[model samples]
Target chain A: MLALAWANLTHHKLRTTLSALAVGLGLALFLVSNGLATGSIGEVADRMESVQAELLVLPAQENMVFSGGAVFTPGWTDHLASVADEQGPLATDVIPAYWSQITMGGQQQRLFGIDPEQMPLFLGDRGMVAGHAFEQATAFSQRIRELRATADGQPLDTLLDDDEWSAGLELVIDDRLRRVGQDGHPYEIGDVVRVLGREFRIVGVVESGVAGRVFAPIETLRLINDGGRQRSTMFFIKLRPGLDHLVAARLFTEQLGSTVQVQPTSDYGRRLQQELGKVFMYVNVTNTLALIVCFLFILLTMYTFVLERTREIGILKSLGVTRRGLIGLSMLEALLISSAGAVIGIALSFVAQAIIAMRLPLLTVELPPQHLATAVAIGLVGGIGSALYPGWRAARLEPAVALGYE
Target chain B: MISVRNVQHNYRHNGVVESVLHGVNLAVAEGEFVVLMGPSGCGKTTLLNILGLMMSPTSADSVALAGTETLGLSDSARTRLRRETLGFVFQRFNLLPTMSVRSNVALPLRIRGQHADGAVDKMLDRVGLLPQAGKKPGRLSIGQQQRVALARALIGRPAVLFADEPTGNLDSASAGAVLSLLREFHRDWGQTILLITHNEHLVGAGDRVLTMRDGRLHD
Candidate 1:
């Protein structure tokens, strides 16, 4: 029976190949869609957790992953530090940070601004991959003072040359940015990237997922925001060892009142996942549709195949092949075809992943083992489910009538 | 061994009743070779079909194969009887084209859920097709294909063999070869045979001959 089923498929090479390809295409679509959904969300969550913070003091009513402009006054940094000290030493460190998006290499890149002195605590072991961290705080202060002295109550750009102003500022960028632009060239150390109408030299390249793609001194970001506005976006707090983040978050909420929302840093990933629930919903719908398309493809293919083999089926019945045996033969053919399709789908998924990586470097496509297993399962279920009716039809065929079928 | 009495068959097409067999009766003892002869559309094949358990007569007083009553049996039970007691060689060979000759010859036993245990190879060797067993049926000549079909039918050592114009599609020489092989099997194994043919010359090969015309039979 197995030999017969396999021989039938191989004898009709074009038809069998087309059926397998159709099923493979459907499975591939499902795998890529599912990969993108989980990949993007997982990347965001993992990046958030990589910051190594215990709690976050977000601007009131702001729960999104990305928001533009400064939302908290710079004075909140001092106030939060003072409050944490008074609240039974609730936190060991309180770091106010600013973030904004900037366009570079025709892509929107996240830029985080942190105090030069506090970066070591936030970065942990995922330190610079090239060059060095931001200069000592005193050196940055000295540069700011020199800029003020040269400005003499006028715009710094007007007072100094582009090279002179850019030479004094430094930017620590993510390693991924090293290979930017359509040319696929790397941005080496000392290379300048223009942002906010001022060029800043790249001082270091850091591993990705350390808060943002690019990091700069908070003073430099403050200078760029609305012509040196005195405001920050959020605060990252590290609690004292053995302190419960939830309890500390509650205490901070009370101290700051309703002006700020405090939450454990661990919740950031879960929050982002919830925020993108609609993406996951769309993936699920597409996955279902893909499998349905596969089912329909197999159903149509097997029906036509059975119709063409009516006389052969009669011959088997005449040879004493039971109805159940006929059904088994049909199902076995379906299984072989579906197994072929699954292999093709997995191969196509990897090709799709490569293309995505080449075309959209910023996007992450994760082909987890679970998703691969699901794709294979979809193929088997779709193939077998769709074969049921056709198998039954073949088994139910009257031997004499089928032998006479034209 | 086969027995039948008062067996009738009718077919309806497009709301019109077409009676194909009327009051047919047949009895062939074990090891007896019987030839059923009739012109096309004269119901020889229909009667053979009824005796082979491939069709149920519209009405039958009694029908038995190997002493087992066949009428009133379920379709599955009839299929089992066909598998265990009867073999058939159709005019067109009816070989599954996709399978190699060995696989085709091995089919009956496979359907019975029995391992060939070298029976397939031994049968092929007996039919002078052992060397061609690896080839697909389509690659064989008409005579070779007929021999393959014969090997398949006899593989299970069935009690009765039904040959419906088994040599119809073969040349005279190929037909002679097939007939010789059938005679050889009957002579050595005493295999009861019910062969249907329109050719008068082939009638001499059977122990007895029966003729059919207009839905009735005459011995």
Candidate 2:
């Protein structure tokens, strides 16, 4: 029976090839679309996880990590420490951070302003890829207390300020800046870049994968972003080692009052992935539509194949072939065609991935085993299902009338 | 043996009643060979269909096959009876053009849940086309194709054979060859053969002859 179905398919080379190609194309598109989406989300998730902070306490109402952040008193960091003393174990330490921007050689760069003293508690000083690690890697308050002695009887904030009462902000350049830079000149350690009339010196260069370009002290960013007002954009709290981070985050969220939103750093990556999924919701839509189209195309293709073999069907029936036998034959033919098409589609997915990578190197396309299996399974289910209508119609064909068909 | 009485068959075309067979009756004894001769549209093929169990009689007063009443048989039962008792060869050879000659010959038995084993080989060998068993029906000459069809029809060793204008599409040489094969089946195996044809020469190939005209049979 299978041999007969195969023979019939091979007998019409052009039609069979075309139908298989159509189904193959549908699967290929689905695979490529899904691969790109999955790969991109995985990358973003990995990056978000690298932050390593247990909780991020954001200002009430707005928490855009990039821009338009809600500005609140930098005094909130001071309040958190006292609260930790009272609430004990709610949060071991809170680091105030700010986002600032700068223009260098007509190109805009993002700056992440973090407390230099508190940064070492979460990330090691070795975050610096080149030049030198942060000189103040120890406890920030201890370093400030030591610097206060050399302040020559001045206050700590005034002493931390650089020449002309402006703090000399230390900047770490991201490697991405060098990659996008023009030839003959590149940013190196000690080179001073002017940000808003303030000459900020680059102390180290870090890999862009881990950190951003133009990192400055939180106080420096507050001074620059708010015209000397010491207001931090957000606070990142690191829970003490071995403590349940979820419990700590929940406790801190309640302490921050109703307006503030406290998000666990662990769940942030997943939330970002979910947001990205919503943005690419059309990929799912396309996948479903492609599956439906695949089914219908196979159905119509198999239906036509049966119609062409109407006289042959009649011949079989006259030979005592049963109705179930005819249906099985038709379904087997469709199964073979669809299976071939599925293989073609999977094979072509790699080609599609390669082409996408070549054309847009930043975009990733992956065809994992589970995803491939899902695609193939859908192709086959849809293939067999689509043939049912036509198979049934063929099965019910009366041998008498069909024999008499011209 | 086959027995059919008052077998009436009709079909609708564009919602109008168009009767093809009207009160036809037929009988052929065991090991007997019969030929039905008729003009085009004389309902000879229709009678062949009813007797072959390809179609049921619309108004059969009584119909029996090998002493069993077939008119009252369920569709599946009638189909089983057809598989167990009958075979067919058509004018166009009606070979499954896609299948090889061996597979084509073995199909009748295969549909009845029997393995080909050596049955296909025996039939092909009997038809003198065992050498071409693996070749498709299209690759053979018309006479060779007719012989393959004959082998397929007889592979199950059916109790009866119905050849409907088996030589209508064949040339003189091919037709003579097919008729000769029919004669051989009847003489050597005592096969009960009912063949339909308009050619008067085919009558000599059968032990009995009948004619169909205006949807009724005549002796």
Candidate 3:
């Protein structure tokens, strides 16, 4: 029966191809939208993990901690430090850092400020890939030493060295800094980058694994914020081994008494994800409606195909073909149409994703195994459900009347 | 052998039930060549439909084929009987247009779930359409398509063959050729054949002639 159905479908090649194309377009939209929705959620989780912070501290009144940008008095850091120092059973180290977006070299980069001296304790064996750690005693020693060894000694390497005498600002750009400037080498360590009419020397280049980011000294970041020195935007704390992040977060909230929002790393990330998910819910809804509409279209078209072939069905019936056999044949036809559509749609989606990735590097569209499985399941369900009414009509047709039809 | 007893049929049009076959009874023995002759509205086609098992009377005790009773059979069982014991060639040459000539010829075999190996070629050859087997029915002449339909019907080796004006759509030459082939097959194989036609001139070749008028068969 399936073999007969297949032959019939192929017999009308043009109509079959057109019908398959219609189904394919609908399935493509469904698959592409689902991939993007899942990808956005995954991207948020990935960004949170990259921060490597066990706990996050933000202003208490902040409803959306990830997006609203934490704003609190710099004195809050001192309070958190004192609380950690005096703790007996649940003592932990708290590191305070400030973060904000800044425009430099005509591109937006996230700026991070950390106290050089205390950073190693938090980083702990995680050293920089490029420059050495900041040394306070000989803070200006390496620059002066390298400058004196140059042939001219005329302060020609002034931007690379001499951060104290030239300006207190220092820029730590990411590996993507390679894209800027004529030489395609946008101001390496000790070179100057002008931001908002202020020139800052690139004291170091920090290669954070995630792309499109930059970091600077705490003092330099304060300068970039127009002398807002005492305030910090975020406080990151690392817990001791075997110490639960939730326990540490609870201690902070208890000590602060709602003066700030204290949340574990995972919880904060999840909250951020939830906020992002709200924006994509509309997309999911629209795509779902589109898929439903597509299912209906497939049903209608396949039903019409069956109707148009009524005489043929009648002939088969008069020839001793059982009702179940006829139904099976129609279902096989439906399945062939659906499976063909799914394969074309999924293949086109992969191609589209690849093309978009080339244009937008950050857009990662991956069709996982579960996604493929879902598409196939949708096809099967669509095939069976769409064929039911048509198959029934064909099965119920009386051969005598049909044979007499013109 | 085939027997029909007191069979009646009617058509309803806009609340009017017009009787077409009124308690008609007829019989044809094995190896008989019977021709039914009638005017357009004389129920010739309706009688042929009943004889082919394509329809059943509204009220009747039995329409028997060989030794088995057909009136008590279920719809599917009747269909099986028709498939195994009957073959039909229609006036319009109702071949599936989407199918090739070979496929159309092999349709009955396929429907019976029989192995179609060499069956298509043999049937097409028997109909003298071997070279045109790959063409669709729509591409063929009315006579050629009629031959394909004949091949499809005869492929199952049915016990009784029912033809309703089988050459009505053909040219005179094609029509004569088809009629000659039918007569030859009937004579050579000793197969029972019932032919319905309004053209009384063709009745001379049949072994028996039954004329129908006003919903009754005349001896």
Candidate 4:
């Protein structure tokens, strides 16, 4: 039976080819649309994972830290620390961080200032790629502190206690600025740089694995920003192990009052993902409309084939072919056309993804196995469904009358 | 064997009734070569259609095949019986132009769920056209194409063969060749053949002949 159906299809090569092409075009559109949507969401998740923050504390109503323009008051960090001390084991440590724009190498770069001692606690031991982290015993509260007692006549402690000792002063910059430095090399360790009229030694360079960003010690940032009396833009917090993030978030929000917002880090990532998902959904809907239009075009093409073959149908009926057989033959023809189209469409999707990825490095279209299977199934159903009415008309034809006509 | 009693059919044009066949009755026995002779619009093809189970009578008293009444048979059943027990040849040869002569000859067997490769070879060979089986009907002479259609009709080894002006479109030489092949099949296989024609000269070849005028069969 399949052989017969195939033979019949090959008998009219032009018609069969046209019908298959229509179905193939529809399948290709569906695959490319879904790949783009999936790729967009995946890119967002990847970017968030690279940031490596356990929790992001922000205002409750803010949607995005960068775009929402959220600001934390100067006293907010002190108030959060007090609340953490009162809370049980669920509260770990909170680090104050700020994001600001600064002119560097004739380009505005985003600067991140973090507490040097607490940074390693959250970012792990691989802190600075080029220089060492700040020494823990260094005096943080006063301008100068006495070093280990020396065996000199005046005693080394008195000399080290003077404010002139500045060897430990350090700053960190990102790799991007290193490429665009005035001397063809960005600041390295022991290199003094001026920022906001304050001189600081470049003790290290850090690679955040993100583009367009720089990092500096909190004390040095305070000096550059003319003291840390003003608020910061972002904060990173860590919770005690095995604590329910939602419950901890609720407790923190209640304690901090309405002036600040507390959110679990994962939840923030999910919200960003959802925003990206909406954009993808819009594209999906547009593709669905295009698919419907393609289906209609296929219907028109198949209908024309049926109309042209009315006499053949009549002859088959007169030869005592069953109506079911006729319908089966038509469906088989549709299935073959659709299957061929689906395969071609899937191949075309890969090609399209490659082309798009070349132009947009961040956009990587991936065709999962599920997406391929779904595209083929949709093509088959669409082909068979569109062919139903015409097949019925052919099946119900009266052989005697049809044979009588031209 | 086939029998019909008081079968009537009509055509409706804008709600007006125009009867084509009225009170038509006839029978043809197994292995009997019968001919239905009539002029144009004499309802010969209509009766043949009723007997072939291709169309149903509007006011049928009784139409039976091999002792079974056909009125209760569903459309699909009728179609199956036609595929299994009957074969038809038409005036125009009616060969599928896209298919080779062998495939055209094997169509009825193919429709009956039989493998056509061997049957097609044997049938075409019997018609002395095995050498030309690869050619399409359009490439064959009218006589050869008619023989191909006949081969198709007889490939299933049906109980009866119905030929409606089977040689009508051929020249005299081609028509003679087709008639000779039909007679050879009838004599060799003892097949029951019912042929319809407007030409009266061919009636003598049949074992029995029935004439129709004004939609009723006569002696």
The TM-scores, one per candidate, come to 0.86, 0.78, 0.76, 0.71
Error of 3 at A288 (Å): 3.5
- Give residue B25's error in model 2 in angstroms: 2.0
Residue B213 in model 4: lDDT? 92
Per-candidate TM-score, first chain only? Answer: 0.85, 0.67, 0.71, 0.63
What are the per-model DockQ values?
0.71, 0.57, 0.46, 0.39
Model 3, TM vs. native? 0.76
Q: Judge candidate 2 at residue A9 and give its lDDT.
A: 87
Winner of 2 and 4 under lDDT: 2
lDDT by residue (tens digit), candidate 2, B1-219: 888889888888899988988888888999999989989989888888888888877899877777788877876787788888889898888888778898889888788889996979987887889999999888999889999999988888888998999998888988888888888887888878889999887877778889898998999
**Candidate order, DockQ descending:** 1, 2, 3, 4
Quality of model 4 by C-alpha lDDT: 0.72
- Ten residues in sequence with the least summed lDDT for candidate 1 chain A: A156-165
Query: Which has the greatest TM-score?
Result: 1
lDDT of 4 by residue, A109-156 (tens): 566666666645534433566775544213431332122223334433
Off by over 4 Å in 2: A2-14, A31-43, A63-68, A76-235, A273-290, A361-370, A403-406
**Which lDDT tens digits does candidate 1 get at residues B141-176?**
999999999999999999999999999999999999
- Candidate 1: segments with Cα more than 4 A from true spot: A1-22, A66-70, A85-88, A105-107, A116-124, A127-164, A167-172, A177-180, A183-204, A298-310, A404-406, B3-29, B41-47, B55-63, B97-99, B213-219
What is the DockQ score of candidate 2, to 2 decimals?
A: 0.57
* Sort order, TM-score high to low: 1, 2, 3, 4
Which regions in candidate 4 have their CA more than 4 angstroms from the true location? A65-68, A73-269, A273-307, A358-366, A402-406, B13-16, B39-42, B96-100, B115-117, B134-142, B199-205, B208-219
> Candidate 3 regions off by >4 Å?
A64-70, A76-229, A238-269, A273-284, A355-366, A404-406, B13-19, B56-61, B97-103, B118-121, B131-141, B214-216
Clashes of each: 0, 1, 2, 0
